[model samples]
Target: MQKLSQTQFDFIIIGAGSAGATLAARLTENNQFSVCLIEAGGKDTSPFIHIPFGLAFLSRMTNLGWEYDTEPQSQLNDRSLFWPRGKVLGGSSSLNAMCYIRGVPEDYDRWNDMGAKGWDWQTVLPYFKKSEKQQHGESEMHGADGYLSVSDLRHTNPLSSTFVDAAEQIGLSKVTDFNGPDREGLGFYQVTQENGQRCSTAKGYLTPALTRSNLTLLTKALVEKIQIIDGVATGVKLQLDGQSIELTANKEVLLSAGAINSPQILMLSGVGPKEHLAENGIKVKVDLPGVGQNLQDHLDIIVQHHCKNRDSYSISLALIPRYIKNTFNYLFNRQGIFTSNVAEAGGFDKTQYAADIPDIQYHFLPAILLDHGRTTAFGYGFGVHVCGLYPKSRGEIRLRSNKPNTPAVIDPHYLEHLDDQKVMIDGVRRARKILAAASFDKYESWEVGPGPDAQTDEEILAFIRKNSETIYHPIGTCKMGDISDVMTVVDSQLKVKDIKGLRVVDASVMPSLVGGNTNAPTIMIAERCADLIKQEHK
Candidate 1:
């Protein structure tokens, strides 16, 4: 391969998703280094990109999402699952439900125990604070001024508030903040919004960073592979505009390309398991088999129920006029139904016994979501999303072939661990208990999904195994630990242990899946990684 361009950048960050954009922005602040960020997706300019409630619609919108699905799972009735990842500048943070969750403190403490230095609760807290700006004002646990927007929803639907009040009726406490010092009980969620609009990572970090001359962002460019010379990452091979091009990295090459693509890129570039590469007819750059192991994600089994009144959100021709009004208000006044993030409020709670934090989390929807896409028939219903916070399940990602655009073998291997199955079972049972309680009976007319028929532990397990789907919080592919830890792909500083000048700084590096939404924690990881890079240069 010829050296197409002689220019070299101090840093080249692949996949301008959540972590890539963030790191590129912070690292270029010094103006002493040039940064190049490459993203395969187009710009984040869609109207739904800023609307909170529009996420339900965006998941089906193929233009903005990377509609990746997992291989059939043995545990889930052999069902193939859907995985919607944002392919744009902000990544999933641009298309997600906008829920702001920092996970639990114990999540980071476990990282410290696994030899990931400076990743404990105390060390990571500042990074979280630095990445976000809490609307409720700063406290010891929260920050006020930061790149990411964190604010309470403006037009909170009445039913969501009623749901919270009903929880108190059922003797469940209404904890203010799940990301606070203590994590427990049900509460209204603090969303990643700014004045009734979605404030994505691109809007927060990359957009502003574009003003600086040191930062160069290239969209609609796919990173096909990393270029390694003498076991050192030197550049990248990418495809854009119907042609392939090569670019060099002067200092370091960072792979913040999420879990699925990051590991796939490493393997495609000959840096994965030696045997797998040999079988696939690719020369092995390194024999790091752990490049695509330890995949984990939350599985949510929705329980829908018919409502007694007209509070449900069912957009029909009859309601199209109302939706039009709501959309106008969002564009002009920045309020109304468009501002309401339907997956508004929920929390974590222990299933078996008393504990400081909750082992399970809930996503309370104000409208009926029968399936992935809106069908010709519609009804009035609300859903309770039950998920296991700390799942013991583990999966792996392997290269399907050497092709860069080829989808990898993503095996969530959900419920492979018996304990994970138990937790999910308990989660379903607990959701039923909540719906059956007096709080739910006050407004709920009928049990729709996994209804009264799906009873008993066996029935619940069967229902969960058949109907459950991922919450899109996959992590732990390129993990970090001591060098001797054979399963870990990165060291404490996030560098690939066997390959020099190459590192992966994304959710893929998370050794364990964070107990809550992966968005906030993913941004925090970028802040922490930026510090590591800065200290090394100093």
Candidate 2:
């Protein structure tokens, strides 16, 4: 144990990612309120973070990520899947695909129905609008004057457009916007980009507010535990550059360390299940049984093919001249191949398991992506990533030990439920159908993943178990619900049920997983939390 020196602020926010960055910026708007935003990783200075197409290389960079892995899931052929979470200032938003999706209205409405009051579509829509600066201008569904910039892709591979055409050929309607009223369709995805660069929360919210006298940003600071005295979270104890430091928050200690870290922090602070805490040699405090339970994530399987033409993005000697031209094009105009977010086009569709809304999602990449883009395939190719939107399977994050630096045991239990398995099979079949459409005749060649041999339902299930990986959307660890629900870790206000001056203001508080990407919705949660905290303090 190291000796600590104390520092104080009006609010101390853990993790300077999407939610924390937004909260730190919004809370410090009133000059009187001082905010300290602490991040485990260094600054978002990586060129890969800002460059839209750099995500392919970004996935392989271990320095910018938490570098977590699951506990060998049995359903997935006993494989331990890698979970890369952003450790940088903007967090995962800086490392994500930059797709600006806010799921369907029913997603939030379901949250309200699940006991999260004031979180329905109508109540939450304003916060979504408040956080977005839509390129198409303001409308009933969007806002034009917000911090995060959302724009249509300036550059896309020809194969991506062909994918949209192919989906249309397979009977899926062409949709201009997935965020609008009509959600079920295939089309190009809008990205969180401005001109060409990614509009991560660090760029959109934190960077502009850095010069503020009231805001303090700390990087490479790992929070060990919350300083909870008499069941009230007074501050946090963290390790900064091999030295221990205690930060006190006069108003509140906001935990926006994301889904994994948020719950892990609570458990480290002795706020988790009593039995589990005792096993890890931790003294019990709140004994919240739901601290690390109810973990859910989107598991994706790729349907890939070798392209007959050179239109797809790939590493080949034949494309050297094109690469050189694209390099200069990006350097001068911020356009060309470098401007493309690999998953350029995608769509939403309902499987047989779905009732009304889309239960399966597709991300069409004009390249051969393997191992989250960590493994490179040589030849020209394209792939469609498919994921079951609503997974019936549930997993949990548990402590490896009482130590904070030691990575937590993450078990997503992917494809544990029969319904999830069935949904994934349907999603893969839909993707294959679109790829086989007449529109792809010019570029399509032989199938790469789950080859032609995988034809039957049993074979498809086996292929899914062998090939599935996370699409990076994880939520519901510190679930929010009404008082009647025992699993509710936080209430509608995001405050810890029995703790004072503490709140979990990130994706963890979602009652259930949203229909699409979690980044946009996570920002909205923080935007709403800032207002909730302001009202109480005012």
Candidate 3:
């Protein structure tokens, strides 16, 4: 075992992900403070991570992500669903579908109403603009010179456009931009990409910051726990290449390990619920009851169909020639089928149960996606993924053991509430109507999932229970709230309650789940937190 000569830094960031990478880059921008970013996984140098279409195969690669499985959900036929989170330099941003969506303003406004001060729609909008570099240039709503590139997809399947038209045919408006004022409509989603390549946080933020003299990056380092002394976080003890090392944080220890790991790290550090810690045989440091509670995620159900036309993406002997031709097109011009994000088009709309804002979201894929795209399905087909935007059901993440490496027991308790189940049924029925529209008449063949036989509400609910999965947006494990709330782990400023020099800067700090894709919102949270930290230090 070897010991490091230098063991101190102004800030120590755990998990070099979307939030961590942004914080690391922003904190070290002035070179006045030193930062150390530690990641459990190795570098994200894989071609699959850079190429947009390569997302189809990312779920199968175990090394790049923590392939977590939820505990058997009683509400979903007792199925333990797969949950994949990136462990590499860019974290989930490198593995995500790259949909750059910031949910409507009401989402943030609700956060403020829920006791998270200074986090309303108007207050957080600047942070969203500050972190984005829109392809269409600067505006009141977007920034042109940000580090994270946001651009239109260089290529998209024709069926994606048809899906938009189908929505319009059903009286839904064709929204040009989902981020604009009017968000409830169908549209082709702009992605977090540049020149047809995925612009992960590793590419957009961390890569440029690597040359800074005051910044340090340690990959393949497993953080065992945070070291707290007298109710104050001092440093972290980690295992690096079979060697134990301790790195002290002079200013603060920022936990950006996302929803699951961030809370798990705090628990492992003995800063969680007293009873749970005692049960695990670990000495409790801070008895915070909300360390791993208030778990929220978007549960999705897919409505698939067989397409008579061969235009949809399919793996077969007939398409091999086209794939070969498109490969060269992408290599030379950075265009063609290889540039498609697969779930290229989507929409937001209100259901019968919605009061005002959209209650459901859609992601239309020009191919068959079964088992999180892990299972290969041949022939021409398409699918529309429907998910209720706001679910009342809540779940928790708990420690299975005292060991840091042991994966946490995740139980989302999806559809535990009757309202969530009803919304999902409505969402599926809405998707069926869109597919049945005239715009898809030429290509549509037959329903593949929740097929013609499952038309009734009971049948649809049963199908949802048998087939639903997470849309990869888990959050609120370590929620930010007012001090009066006993379950609140962190405050509005993101500092842990009653713990000095410790903060959580990730999706884990969200008080409620946003209405759309979470990648852009997660980046926005870090951008706002960076300024808050800088102000405090100054």
TM agreement with the true structure for every prediction: 0.96, 0.98, 0.99
Residue 491 miss distance in model 3 (angstroms): 0.6
Kindly list the per-residue Cα lDDT of model 1 for residues 180-299, writing each as its tens digit: 777577788999999888888898888889999888788888899999999899999998787888889988999999999999999889988899989888888899989899899988
Report model 3's TM-score to 2 decimal places. Answer: 0.99
Candidate 3 residue-wise lDDT, 1-538, digit = tens? 3335479999999999999999998998978999989999999989999999999999999999999999999988999999999999999999999998999999999999999999999999999999998999999899888889999988888899899998768989999999999988899999999998999999999989999989889999999999999999999999999888899999999999999999999999999999999999989999999999999999999999997688899888888999999999999999999888898999998889998899999999999987988999888999999999899999999999999899999999899999999999999988999999998898847997999899899999999999999999999999999978999999999999999999999999999999999999999999999999999998
User: Of 2 and 3, which scores higher on TM-score?
Assistant: 3
- Ranking under TM-score, best-scoring first? 3, 2, 1
**Relative to the true structure, how large is the alpha-carbon lDDT of every model?**
0.85, 0.92, 0.93
Any residue pairs clashing in model 3, and if so which? none
> Clashes per prediction?
1, 0, 0
TM-score, structure 1 vs. true:
0.96
Candidate 2 lDDT over 333-449, as tens digits, reads 999899888999999998888998899999998888888888987888899999999998999999999999999999999988999999999888888998899988886488978
- Whose lDDT is greatest here? 3
| Candidate 3 stretches greater than 4 Å from native | 1-5
Q: Which portions of model 2 miss their true places by more than 4 Å?
A: 1-6
Q: In model 3, which range of ten residues has the least summed lDDT?
A: 1-10
